[model samples]
Each structure stands twice: as C-alpha cells, then as structure tokens.
Target: MTAGTANAQRFREFKMPDVGEGLTEAEILKWYVQPGDTVTDGQVVCEVETAKAAVELPIPYDGVVHELRFGEGVTVDVGTAIISVDTDPGAGPAGAPAAAAAPEQAAAAEEEDAEPQGRQAVLVGYGAAPSSTKRRARKPQPGVPAQPEPVKAQLQAELNGRPAAVPTPAPVAPAAVPTPAPAAPVPPAARPVGAGAAGRPLAKPPVRKLAKDLGIDLSTVAPTGPDGIITRADVHAAAAPAAAAPVAPAEVPVAVAPAAAEPGIVDTAARERRVPVKGVRKATAQAMVASAFTAPHVTEFITVDVTRTMKLVQELKQDPDMAGLRVNPLLLVAKAFLVALKRHPEVNAAWDEARQEIVYKDYVNLGIAAATPRGLIVPNIKDAGGKTLPQLAAELGDLVATAREGKTSPAAMTGGTVTITNVGVFGVDTGTPILNPGESAILAFGAVKLQPWVHKGKVKARQVTTLALSFDHRLIDGELGSKLLADIAAILERPKRLITWS
Candidate 1:
C-alpha cells in the first residue's frame, strides 16, 4: 500500500493484490492466521487457489496477522483488505517515516476508535501492502505428469508419496450469464423450504422469464432437473400446459430483460469480467487442456450390476449404531475404490514431463467434483484411503456443504491423488469425464437404477449402474484402465470382496 501525507505514522495494513498475474478476484481459500498470529515475511499465511492451481499464499508484510476478514474459501476481489501489518515506512524520498495511511483513512480510524473504544478496523484496506510478486505462480507439484489423464496419476502419486500437481481450472467466460436452457429452473421435487438457495440456484433468468412470458408460475413448474432445477424446456413446455393463464407484461420483463441485458453487460461489463483462473476448475482446465492437446486421451465404459451394494445400503441403515447418519451407495463406492486402488496402484500415478518419469502415490486424497455457486470446486478428503465408512461419508458431506457455500479453501482442494464424480446423483447413467491435471485417471459414477437381472437362476429386479473411466493414454493403456475399472466394479458388485481383499 502506498503512503499518503501521513507516511510518518507507518503502514497499517496489507491488502490482497491482483495475484492471478492480472486476475482481479480470488476466493479466500484458507487463512493461516487470525488477528494476532505473528508472521514473518514470505511465510505462507494462507492457501488461496485461483481457478487453476492451488496456491499457498505467503505473507508479504511481516507482522501480527490482525483480523481475518473472512474464513476459508471466501472470494475476495483484488485490493480487498486481507491483513494488517506494522511496517516502518522508510523515508518517503525525504528522510522521514511517514504515517502509513491516507489522511482521510487515518482520521476515520481515529474517529472509529474514539467511539466504541474498540478497533472495528474496517477501513476496507486498513492493513494492506502491495502483494508480493513471488506469489504469482503456484508452486508446481513434484513429478507432475504431462499426460492427458492425470487424475489417475494423481492417485498413483499419492500411493507412491508424490506431490500432486493440479492444472488450474480453465477460465469460464466471465460474463454473468443466465442459466442455460438445460440448466434453468430449480427442482420442484421438494426440498426443505429455503434449504438449497444459498449457492447458485438452478433457475436461469430466461427460463424464469419464459415461464412468466407464457403465464406459467415458478412454483407450479414441476422441476425435472437435479437439485430441483426447472429447465428452459420445462418452462417452455409448461407455458403450453393446460390451465396456464394469459401472459402478464410486468412479470415477463424480469425473465426476458436478463437475456438482453446479459449481452450489454458482457460487452461493457466493468472493462472486462475478470475471473481468477485458479484452484480446482482453473487447475483442472489448464491440465486437461494441456493434456488433451499434448497428451492423448482414451476413455472406457463399463456396465455393472451393483444390486448388492444398494441392498447393503439398506442393511447399513438398519444398524442401530448408524442411526442419525446419512449412509448411501457412495460411501460403499468410496470404500470399494480404496480397495481397488490398492490392487492397481498403477492407476493412481502421474507422468512427469520435466524429468521424463511416471510417479505414483501412496495415499488418496480423493476428490469429488462438486458443482458449487462459485463454480466447480473439488475439495478432497485427505488420506481417504485410511478413513472408515462413516468418516468418509461425513467428510464428503462437509466437503459438499463447504463447496456449495463457497467456503472451500485452497488446501482443501489440493493434493488429490484420485477423483470420483457421482454423476449418479444427477441421474446420469454415464459420461466420459475429463481428467484432473498431473494425475493419471478419473472415474465417473452413473445412476443406480432398478433393472431386470438374472439372480439365483431366475430373473429378478436388481440395482445396476454404469462406470466410466477416462485415462491418459500416455501413461495408462486399455489393459491398465480395464483392470482398475473392473476391480472397482468387482468390489461394488460384492461388498464381501472388500473384506477378502483387505
């Protein structure tokens, strides 16, 4: 922070800078300091991931970290006050330690302090310093793979004790957009009142507009999409539904204006809609784009009969000890992956371009691709291979909530050796997913549905699901991916196999 006429007093704060090389805002991933933690210059005081890579942010000013403005994963725009520092402002070209504050700011602080006898310390950028240039680049992981399918390599690296490198998420077009046609309207499938509205609500303005444009009401639109979202098609269809009334001009404007306004805002949107391409999406996009074009990508699909696993979900629920806890097929699947990962550790490794090597991992900080209000973020469970069923489920739950609330810190999203996408939650039966950079593979879980199957010599209703594995052909071959995918399916097919394997 530059000094004003009051430079003799000294610098009182350090604000977060545009750290994405030129990016404007970043989610506060995590804070390593509270108000009074004494810190040295260059000591990592926080971990903030831009949309791309997980970045460990170091303190630029040495001082006691005064008040943390927000907790982990709070997105802060550039120039926002992050911490305050006590700096001896060197003679400002004129041998005198100037007050490190703007005259107006110093006066304001003085007034604020006099009233409450307490330092609310809310000058916005009271304790701020110019961000260090060093923090510009996120530290590269050890032995990162250049292969297209690095998600698996991420897992393998953990198993082999290698550091994971996540390419940052690709930058999404920064213009604020109304929800897409398919992504419009939140579900009417019934949720606790106002429970899931904090993050990105599923409804897009246009779809909402369409509903109003056609005289359909929002509550009346039975959402057919996940998270109770009402899609554009649903709105259009509902417009023609029987019992719909004549369109009202006033209500139609909110929905339709957004579409017209969206473009104008994009063209004239604050110079440019600036976004930080760091953290999970940023890292994932950079790595995937780099890998997809540089390294070859190969994907495989498998259909499995997970009837027993669904039955086991019920059995686990019946246990008195399991009461009050949420237990589902994912917990079992997570366990199965751990078991499978042990057998095919090769699947959880990365190809290092700098050294021309393939590195493997020993533990799994299994990442789950979570769609949050801030965009897609992946907060992984550290050392997931060691957690028990209940623990895993609980952690997953917390991770989901954190991401949805935009509270996922940079550290939480870092160091994942493997990842799983529960597309099943979205009613998706299959998808060829993208790989997280630096790791070897990625797994997608499809919806578990009831289907006819042969059981005990007779046809019976059984739960079934499909699994899709996307791998980096540079490091993983069809044979290896098949082995890993088959191993996972085998365990999900029979939970008892876990015991045998263990």
Candidate 2:
C-alpha cells in the first residue's frame, strides 16, 4: 500500500520492435525522454540503428516515463522491454504487493510451460519470446559428485576475499576413500576462471567473435566484467601482449635500436586502437568484399575539358527556375551520367547469376554515393532517368542532405541500376572506383583543375578533370564500357550535348 505499488499496477512496458526487414536487434543510438517526463501517444522516445539504417522509434501510448531499461549504444534483442511507463499517476496506493506479485507469478508460469507460446503483437514484426532469456538447471556429470554445501560456502568466501572458516570434520575410516591417480600439473595461468559449471568461458557472442578474430584463447583471459563475464576490453587486453611481444630472431636486429634506446619506455601497443565494426559500416564491409571477389572488374579512365560544364553550372545557378535548387558540378555530372545511360541502356542491366540471364532494367535508379560520418552510403533517386533536370536537381538535393544528416531510409538505398561517386569535393584527381553491389557500373568524377591544353589550335589553360568507370566485366564488354565513359566525358566537355541529346 505505497506509491511505488500503485504505479506498478499502472505500468506498461514497451518492448523493442523489429523496426523493419526482420532485423533481430538494434543499437540504441539515443533517448529523447527521461524518467518522470510525460510523453503523449505516438511520441518519439528514442532512435535506434539497425544494419540497414538508423530509425526513430515512437511510443504507442500516453504515459509518464517510469524507467529506461537500456542505455544508449547498447544493442538490445528484439521483443525485450526497453522502457516502462506509468499510465495513471493519481491512483491511490492500495494492494501494491499483490499487483506486483501477479506479474512475477505469471512470468514464472510462462517459464514452467516450455511449449512455445505466441508473443504479444509488436509494432513492426511478430516474433516468439527468445528462449535465451531463460537458463536451465545444470545437471551434474556422470562421475563427478555434487560439492557439499560447506565446501561451496568456503570457496565462495575465498572468492569474496574473506577468510574461510574451517569446519571440524568427524573421524572417517581411511579405507573408505580411494587413492586418486596422479594428474598432470596445470599452470595457474592456464586455469580458466570466470567459467560456467560446464567449464565453458563466460563471454558474450560479440566478445567470442572478437577473441576468434584476434586468435586469443578465452580460457586464458581474465574477466573484469560484472558477474565474471568476459568483456571486449578483456579480450583486447589479452591480445595486446601477443601483438607487442618481441619479434622473431630474424627481425630482432631491426627492433634492437628502439629497444636499446627506450628500454620499455615506449609502449607501441598503447599507440594502437581497435574499434568494433557494427551497424552500417559492418554491412558495407561484407557487401564490398562479396562484390569484389564474385565479379570480375574492368576499369577505364578518360580525361575531359569541363570548362563548358563549369559555365553551365554557373548559368543554372543564376537562372530563375533553379533559384532554390542545388546547382553544382555534381548535379551536372549526375545529369550527364543519366544522359549517357539513356544512350546505352544495356549498361543499366544487372547480371543475375542465379538465373544466368541478363536482367535489363527499364528505369534508372541512379545511386549517388555520399560519405557521411557513419561511413559511405549510396542513396539513389528512383526513376531518375525519367525526371526532368529540375526535378532531378530537387531530388538530388534532398538525397544528399538526408544522407549527411544520417536520416536516409533503407528503402532509398536499394534497387539501384547505376551509380556516380564525386571525388572532386575531396580534391582528388581520379582513381578507379568499385561498383556498388548489384549494380552494373559506377562512375568516378574527379577534380577540375586548370591545365595547359590545345584548344582552337592554340595552347590555353583549360579546366580539365579525369573520369574513371568501373563495371562488372561479366556483363559489360570493354567496348561497351569505353563507350559509356566516352559519352559521359563528351557531355561534360560540351555542355550543349545535354540540351541536344534530350
């Protein structure tokens, strides 16, 4: 009969929804509301990130925030309660103990019934409660007997850094105990601490993966995490010694100079840092690797004088119709790429390996690669080939702005036929670019710099830039690739081509 008990009866817990596309878990990027803050129905409560994209989650009902179940940056499994709210605040405190006890009873009953029961419907996707939340009783092995309570208490006391009380033992006949066989000595360093009853080291899945990648043995790692769980830092600490160990005898002479001068003063390992790859960065890495090895890549490059294109960009900016639209060299480059795709529609096709057939696309979803703080993300403008220059400019502006703000949706990034990456903004000349996964070709637009060139049969300083095109060789022949690159360069060289071609 207290205020705490009254609020417990009115509390509603909100579980983490699937967000989209059957994602199993998401990292809590941020929280918008704190405990004691009143939130309305359909209020934005927090933002989370999945492998595909970052999404904001909204609370479905009105209530006063009771508690936040998870902190920022923690990856929580789907269907786990992430927050709790109290729907009624003015109720009198009565029968609080019984109300709270009811939930505990229900939870115990659910666990006792092992049959898979349907979970409460979620906002995004349907899923059964995860069985991993429950732990089954550990049964003793065939030969090993259970330790007596007194010995268990003594071990616990020692682990807690307290002197164990010695228990007086009754006299037993010596013949009753059998002599044990001699065992091989196990170094204290090799003994596995913080292990479960089954002798398996206590570490999370991500920590295990990290240990596997670093080739570090988990049993040898000391646990510093709560409840004797091995954490990522523990794994990294275990691997640091191996990485900083002395080099082999062949390279010992090379390291001797530094060793002799510093004499352990400089710790090279401390200068190194490791970051766990997750979210968008992790997905991008896996996709790039698959694309590079599975498809044969052929790159072709061309240099073009883009002085005319620069003039057009300036003209467009001054034009009344393009007043609010973003008009830059990249816009013209994107338009030029679309024009080239129109001339050679076959370049927009994808090689479907499973079907062993060329799937030629009718419309172009032109992907524009934008580098954000999260990493490189390419969000395409749908049906870009069919849109007017003004429409394309507007959509392109929104796409880039959304990407830079880290709000681009996953749907906006899929089903692309071709892509253009502008490396000019970074002041790079040009280099071979990789094709995005499932796309046929990618165009790299480089910096435009003044250079000496022959024009009108006279040497003059002209604005020039190099363009690199990388395509899937299995689908595009060298001749086709060359033509696509040439067309893009030609349009940029003579901006009049854009008007005439359309």
Candidate 3:
C-alpha cells in the first residue's frame, strides 16, 4: 500500500513535566520550533522559566509539529499539554481519527497509573495531573441585551490576526422607536487590541494581576508584547499619568473630571514601581522567609588578622602545583572553613524537624552563595569535604560562573550541609546572614582591609577581616558556634594550621 493510503495520522501530545521538585507551572520563554517543523526525540523545542530556574524542555517523540497549545510568555501548569505532534504524518491527513481523539481523551489516557503503550521516557518526572473542578454556570442578568453575532465574529477575527468585514445594520421605521443620541466615539489609543468575545484584553495572568492590583483597566493599556498581549510595563505606563496628576481639595468644586473617577478607567496613587516577583527571585524570597521563621537563628561575629593567609594566597597563585587554579582570599577562606568543619564535625549537620532529630553529617556539601541578575542562588559542590584544595577551587570557580550565567541546575542547589556567602566582594564588613533551609549554618566572609595592628608587640599594618557565622539555635548553642568560628579564624591567621590541622 502507498504511504498516503496506509492509515490515518496519529497525534501525540507533550505535556509540561515537573522540571524541579514541587514546581506547579512554568512560563514558556521562547519556542524554538513552529508548526509543520520536523522534530526528533530529545530535541529542545522551547525554554521555560520555572520558580527555581530557567530550563529548556525537550520533545520526547519524533514527528512533525501539529500545534503549540500555548504561546510564548504564557504560564502552563504541570501535566498540561504544551505541544502536539503528528506521529504518523506519512499517512496524510489525520482525518477522522485525530478528530475523534480529542485533547481531553489524551489527558484521560495519561491519568492511568501505568505508562501508556507508546509513552516515551521524559527528561524530568511527569508530575501528577491537576484535579478538575466543575462549577455551576451563572445565568444572564435581567435587562442585559445579548451581544451581536457579528461583533463576536470580529473579536475572534482580531484574536486570529484577520481583518473582519464590517456588518451593515438593517434600517428601522421612524415610527417604530424614538431616535436615540449617538454614542461618543472611542479614541484609537484607548481602544483595546486582540480582545476576546467577552471584551477582555489579551494578557498573562501576572500582568492581569498587576493591572487588577493597581486599579488599571487592561483594555485601556496599550499592548506592546508579541501577538498584541498587554504587558506589565504597559499597565504601569497607563497608570503613570494618573499617578502624577495633582490632587484637588475636598472643599473646591471642579468642572473638569479627573482621569481617574471615570467609569472603566485607570486610577491609582501608585508612586512606586511594582515588579512581579517570579522565577529565581520568587523562590529565594520564599525560601528565606521559611528559613527565618522555621529555624531559630543565632549569629556570632569575630574579627581576625589574616596577613599570613593573604600572603599565602599570593604565593599559591605563582606555585606550579596550584597553577591555573583560582587562588584568592575566598579560596583560602573556603579551605579554612572546610578545615574548621573537619575539626568540629558536629557543626556540619541539619535539624530534621519532621523526624524530630539533630542529624550529623559525615561529609559536607558546601554551598556558595552567588548573586546573579535573576536573583541570589546557592549552588553547592557535592562531597566538598572529600575534595582537595585545588579540586575545591576548581569546583567553586565552575559553580560561581554557572550561577552568574543563570545556568545553575536545581540539583546543584540541593543537599547542602553548610554555606558560605562572600559579602566581602561587595565591600561589606559583616552581616547576620540567614541559614539556607535544611542546612544548620551559613558563614559570611567580610572585606579584608589593611589596618594598624600590634604584630610581635610592634605597631604595624596587617590584613584584617571579620567573619559572621549564623547557625540553627536548636542544633548549635553559643559554645559550639563560638568554637567553630574561632577554629576558622585561627586557620586563617596562622595559615599553617591548615597543614597541622589536616
């Protein structure tokens, strides 16, 4: 049989998988493939931004692209189909089979416990599908006229990027009804773009929320986003003039009406700019809040002279054995901290609230806090306690570089036993840092500056810096915390303690 007459085309729907632990949804940043484009298994079709990080999603099956369920910048929930593929395109038209098998049916098939017959291995876990809830429909209010069919057609045309034909109304006899006054014409700038049948403007959920919170009508806000979608910036720009307008006195009667007070208009006193919290920033904020509230924190500070450590850093930079390695104060600081942790094994632990136990760790997964354009992320090196100084420095370099590039994986940010945040890079002296959730402690490395010191009973200039260690009060008390901090400081001051202690 010829390929065209073999069988009807079969379609497969690719659902949005849960890329990270407990991630509900992700926003499609961009689509690399379009409809009719051929795609292979494991080929990345789009990039999505989740609460934790930006991740690229790969299509699991080979086929010609049939449809994109959602557009760019649209947030889709896990287990929801994002794209469709024509799996058996050689059979020509999908015809009756594709029509018979609706998206709902495909979703229903995926709900089974065991994998479906043709199911392919997903890159990440396919999360549980969201439960469907049915709601009662509201009846139309009395005295409200039904919308015209032609106007509804026009709205749909606008959504599809098509020019709609103007419909001519039939003439009525003069005696049938009294003549009504002509309605005011809407300004072109004030007109909504790509409106739905219900007259609601096209915008993302976040943008809609921002407009709602700022008391701005989305219809009045010009859409600058792709496909005539209203953006956050557009909403803010619409509210700007109203926000800048001068307020009138309560006693004074004004003839001209304010821009705000008009029906279906934007009105707000929002002086400060509002940014929607999402992606990395949103996750960081939530984690910090949980850590602060759940874990009782106690911060301890100590100032130390690190002249010898600084000199050793310069010496290591020139050494052949440590050649091509990142030899900085942070490198030394991390090594010293690791050595201190080795001496105080009890400090490298986590408080398991669920188990109601203080779990001590045999090895450390040291997390390094790196600040990026997206937000702050802490990507730790696995089994940091077992690595050599050169290996540690290499890992640190890679981790920081990856984090700054916004390519750090969610896996790298988990299983951290201890953390070190280098506030010194920002010229900060010290800070009471919050512990990373699940980790017992976080050490803040302060700026190293030259100051007058009594070296061998003589007044001389020496390198000085301060260190702050914040720990879980429940697991580590003042005595244990102080000893841990003191050990780290001693290693830095002598620079020989690393050799002796190790």
Candidates in order have lDDT scores of 0.65, 0.77, 0.77
lDDT, candidate 1, 32-57, per-residue tens: 77665777888887766566334567
RMSD of 2: 12.7
- In model 3, residue pairs whose N, Cα or C atoms come closer than 3 Å (at least 3 residues apart or on different chains), thus clashing, are none
Off by over 4 Å in 2: 1-11, 20-22, 88-266
TM-score of every model versus the real structure:
0.52, 0.68, 0.68
Q: How many residue pairs clash in each candidate?
A: 86, 0, 0
Instruction: Give the TM-score comparing model 2 with the true structure, all chains together.
Output: 0.68
Q: Against the hidden true structure, what lDDT does model 2 obtain?
A: 0.77
Candidate 2, poorest ten consecutive residues by summed lDDT = 120-129
lDDT, candidate 2, 128-158, per-residue tens: 2122464555665543443446786676445
